[model samples]
Target: EGIFELEYLDLEIGRCRILEPVKVKMVVAKTKEGFTVGGFVKTALEHPCTRCLKPVRLEINGVVEALYLPKNLASFKREKRLETLKNVIYYTGNIVDLSERIIEAIVVEIPQKVLCKPDCKGLCPYCGIDLNEHPDHVCDKISQESDIDPRFSVLMNLKKNEEEG
Candidate 1:
């Protein structure tokens, strides 16, 4: 059993970044073949909202569970790598680093559509201002009444020629 503090900068998870040191508590149980580790990691992440583009702070609490196999045992059988443990993570030395596995667990849990709130007003296409901030925001109205579909261009030209003739 052990506690470790991981402080890293510029660690990017998707488009998010860890703003501080991550706390991890782990317990290792020795097995005949290898060792199994179970723990939890806690940290904070900053990411831009997918809709509003506003910076959103997210609290990450992820459970970490991984199996470590020695180099010889890991390399002896290639099939065992996948068949033995579905979530087995390989390590070389006596020290098993669960950082990579922990990171993977957290990243996978992040949702594809990360919005700041359930109802987020996105930015305006013309002025690029946040619509949420200015509910009454309006842009120059460009009329598309005279615009003709390109697919009907030939018919439009023939009608124009007939009217002019």
Candidate 2:
């Protein structure tokens, strides 16, 4: 059985949950050359939407394959085993902790900005208001006709005369 535990970080990930126990399946096979362990990893977790702060669920599935080379001077620098060594998570003769690994996977899966819906009406740039709830807000459509620069008024008159001609 695989066991993992995680402590909460104070940062607002919004809301999230870990749904299932992490499953690590391993198999050892012996051939004329050597033995290797290869299998799959299954993990499930939840994340929160960055925009409206809603929970989003996720599942991670991956494979793990490593060659068990003898820890001896003769086989110390096997080139073929380099790939396996790079991918494998090594542990000293002690219980391996999956907590950090699980957290890492979850963090990697989180979207930079998660919207509640595809067409989410985000906050108004001018007023810093959420347009979703107050669709009827009149401030959005109140066009500022006075934004024109006073120095440009003579240019506007000149343009109008040119159009008339």
Best by TM-score: 1
Top lDDT prediction, candidate number: 1
lDDT of 1 by residue, 63-164 (tens): 887777777766665664458667876667667667677786667656677788989888877668898999798755322324656787798789779999
Find the 10 residues in a row with the least total lDDT in model 2.
6-15
C-alpha lDDT of candidate 2 relative to the true structure: 0.56
lDDT of each: 0.71, 0.56
My TM-score estimates for the predictions, one after another, are: 0.69, 0.47
Please give, for residues 1-165, the per-residue lDDT of candidate 2 as tens digits: 354453232236544666776676556676444455666556665655455445556665755555444435234555665554654444443344444444554465556766767766766656756676776656643355365467987877797799999
Scored against the true structure, residue 140 in model 2 reaches a CA lDDT of 42
What TM-score does candidate 2 reach?
0.47
